[model samples]
Target chain A: MSTKSRKRMLPWFPGSGAFVDADTAVAAPDTLARVTEDQRLTNDGEVTVASPDTLARDTSEREFATEQWQEVIDRKLVDWGRNPQQLEYEELIPPTRFAIQSAAAIAMLCRDHALAPPMRVVPDGDGGIILERWKGSLSTSIEVARDGTVEVVVVEDCRVVSRQVLSLE
Target chain B: MTSGDGSEPIDKDEIVLRRIPATFEWYNPGLGKPIAWVAFKPNENDRSGISVWRRKYRPPCEVAARNAKPGRRYYVLGLRVALLRAIGITVEPSPLEGGPGHANLVNLSSDAYRRDKDGITQLAKIIAERLTICVDGPFGPFDIDARQE
Candidate 1:
């Protein structure tokens, strides 16, 4: 019986078609490319379980792996600022999920503007977020509060260009 | 932390150091490795330094720096420090510089990520062995001593 027919025969175990034979291999565009081009892919029992796409998927997750900046914003920015609240010491202000998201959003804006992203995203003393981009004596930053209010500051090569309050809401 | 004036040719010569929290997992960022680092003013208001990396820098560079205050406890990845210094970023000799006692004297920087418990434990032990911490009074730079256990 053909592999498809064999899989259909095993109706007792629903979704058993996921188990492809070892020798099975599909010679189409790799599965990952298919995923990138179209948000879905099918394992038609023809693609080998060890296809390049499968290998890529297994090696490194491609979920947030997009372009350089997006990948950095998604993977690095989100997790790098983890701080658990410390009521006892009053010194810890863990990066809130919202703050992390806001920082990344601002970084994405910088990328969209063809500007370099901030070198660091710091929490403001008053419960806000700051994205700092510094080169030499130049400093550019975007400050975001918990309420989604933003302040963008640009200092190019040491001259303060502009500091503006932006409203994303 | 020199805020340069526009006509001063924007000095690119200051060495900005990051105080790696003893347990911060800075190596976990999932993008291309950093090729260079940039300098930014330290937030004087951020007491914990936790917010310094509220989102973390997207570009690769050793962006970590010590706060102006001394004896403030922050962690550093030893690896990144050496790497930064190797590429000529002028990383401070001690991870906890000007902060408290022997914790600043010990080498806590490592190339590996902080998620490696074995690495952190080993480094912690090395730090603990060489320094005697005194938490009697309110913890600050004055609280720690060089007398090792």
Candidate 2:
């Protein structure tokens, strides 16, 4: 038989491409409209009221706090006999870990901000999570699969704000 | 025997396919290792008309070798060319001439036979696919060839 007459099969690559993107900008209509206009400025030499320090503080503070929360989450994951690196790569994090981390992060944020009980944790798919501090005011649901896949969704005023998959362990 | 009348018999041509059972073994003396054996059958209706060909298959080495199991049954099928050559039926060799004399063993590409010592490794793979068995293991570093008597 000719060499080309043999049977062949295709190769396999791991991990289906499933992910979420979260928007961090707090979208208050009037503030967002002003910010959009501010971004369109082209050095017109007009003094803007928006301070760079405030922007820096807002972004950096949350990032630093999230990192600190992640460290604690990492330790907990390791103690639970799950490799954090594998979980991150495989995108499979247990619901227990997700709930723990979410609750802990919210608790830490509340304590730092001196807020009261019943804080809401909303995870946006794009890597941003929101913590609302009102009773029955936020409608966010977390779905977890037995395989350790997590989906977080937020429904507010009949609008979906954050819908995302997160790795907790 | 007492009947004096002569009788005429009618003959009809019919195509018959033969199934011949065969076994192959590879022995490595330096390692004092146990011999690896594969069982297969040759098809009679091969057009190449050759016999005594080598077939390849993936061995369940990880599971079998670790357990020190012997006589593992691997699935395999005989190639028409190899079948014909195995049976002492000689035919014109393909343009590829790597065999001893006119016997043309399947020449698997170098990339395909990267770890294979000879084309027999590829043949084993073909047989395994036909038999629907998983075969993956280190058979040997020596070239396996079909020997006909």
Candidate 3:
């Protein structure tokens, strides 16, 4: 018998397709991206984890890793004289949820400006990826957008502090 | 005038009487080290002399005029004496010339203000008593006329 037929042939078993629903799976990609972004901020340019785990792993390891990354970002923010309290994670928003929101916000702003979609990529280290506008000649603020891209402005009068390619480990 | 010990009166240039503390150091070439000394500035115009307290094994001799830098020696002697007197030690004036003590007193008094850790009050008092300068206070006009060259 065929694989589907054999699965159906089992009397006590439910039908073959036992998978997560679309909304649950769709939410995961953005969640992973936010986690990735948070990791970037905390490592001080060091990339820690690759992809977010979808499985039920040890909670302790995850909590420790999150705390470490949060500390890194918190220190950087404090050093820059920015308040970390403003960046506190909301209960409804997963840490990675912000990445999707930011991306959408950027996209909306770019659309309003009649600009092309900016190339967005997660860089290796804690340093964030550069969102180059107008073919690298002009760059928008990392945490702020003057052109009304996003309301979540983490940086004001964004100035480029340093730029270099970080190695992925 | 002569003392009862038959020593002639210290001439204007012979007997040096610089008031100094009981202990100080003198540069001794024979021992290749600085020997403890004292100063004696006797007359107003006489050059002060420093007497090195030579070790018992070493030969005792008066430092020659040419070999001594009296101005520098007097200043040092004065400084040492001031420090000693601060702690209540009595210093005696020496009769010899051209030793470390004489140079110390002159050197110290001449530029006591410039030297670090030289107490102005103590220096003024020592200068007043030893050089016979009229010191009205720790800082005032005095008769001592040594100036930096």
Candidate 4:
């Protein structure tokens, strides 16, 4: 798609090029702008019929979240160069490509489940990533290991509420 | 003992250490695992304790530390600084900066891990004690019974 047309579509679809998958756009009407944008670019140039209500501004929140997450991945932890270790040691490990991919999946999961953005996105010392969210005294953390397993733990009032592991393999 | 500048020392005897949960609630790791410090005088109610936190560094959290390198040292330092700040030990530069005085506290913290085996643990103890003295709110330094760190 040309940049001009994409820019013109922004007001109606404030979240352009946000989702990589068109199927994701199908769930929310707010995404129709992007979906339409996609359809406009495709060879067929067609969108299957759907009720107008299902195509309204529903994914605004999700789009905003997707953008925020995208910003994190793009930086690739370069901003950490100013810290003490960066000064002393000379260099630090950047986030892995796999880690960024896992983050995207986790962000989509949060969107699908209506979960808020995490308070933190930590990269563990074990070649893994963590997403942490907090509400009052309640805290939830999801660990995405390089092995493709996800561990979710919810703590309330400093006590464990639930702990479960999901296999993404 | 007091420094020539007349400020009192950060007496180990004066600090009351407490054991709490392994993680800090107020810390936002996404903000680059920051190294920051805040200073305040309890009960003095003057302009001393109302200062904003001072950020020293913001190291990126690494994907893994299995292979310790020069870069990995940063992640450790950042966490130590965070832990120290969490427990109320100030890492901010002050008029007492430089020399072997109150400012040496910062120097000591910065160099301790490289100097001694028990350095990290000792620092954590100092921080825990300082935290016990300063943090009175519900947010904590809670879980105060662990005793070992």
In terms of DockQ, the best-performing candidate is: 4
lDDT of 2 at B102: 20
Superposed on the true interface residues, model 2 gives a C-alpha RMSD in angstroms of: 27.8
True contacts kept of each: 0.00, 0.00, 0.00, 0.03
Better of 1 and 4 by lDDT: 4
In model 1, the Cα lDDT at residue A156 comes to: 45
Query: Who wins the TM-score comparison?
Result: 4
Cα displacement (Å) at residue A134, model 4: 0.8
Instruction: Give candidate 2 misplaced runs (Cα > 4 Å).
Output: A1-50, A82-136, A139-142, A157-169, B1-149
The CA lDDT of each predicted structure is: 0.33, 0.28, 0.25, 0.34
List DockQ for all candidates: 0.03, 0.01, 0.01, 0.05
Candidate 2 C-alpha lDDT tens digits along B46-144: 223222212211112211222121332221222344343343323343223322112222233223333432233224323322322222334222122
Tell me the lDDT of model 1 at B101: 14
Poorly placed runs, candidate 4 (over 4 Å): A1-60, A76-101, A111-115, B1-149
Task: Kindly give the stretch of ten consecutive residues in candidate 2 chain B with the minimal lDDT sum.
Answer: B10-19
- Best of the two (2, 4) by lDDT: 4
How should the candidates be ordered by lDDT, best one leading? 4, 1, 2, 3
> Mind giving the per-residue lDDT tens digits that candidate 4 earns over A1-169?
3322222111111112222222221223343354532332222333344345543443554455556555544443333222313312111123344554665565554444332355566554233456655545555556565454565655554344555554333
Against the true structure, candidate 3 reaches a TM-score of 0.15
Compared with the true structure, what per-residue lDDT tens digits does model 3 show for residues B1-149?
22222222222222223222111111122331121111221212222212322111111122221223223222212123344344442343332432222222332331332342124323332333234321111111112242211
Q: Which 10-residue window of candidate 4 chain A scores lowest in summed lDDT?
A: A6-15
**Which of the two candidates, 1 or 2, achieves a greater lDDT against the reference?**
1
- Model 1, A1-169: lDDT tens digits are 1122223110001111121111221112233343333233233434223466755653343322224457557655654444334201133334455666666775564343223334454454234565554544444456566555665555443344555555443
- Predicted candidate 4 versus true structure: per-residue lDDT over B1-149, tens digit per residue: 22244144333333221111112222233342221111111111211221111212111121112122322221122123344455445543343332222122342332433354133333432332233223321222212231121
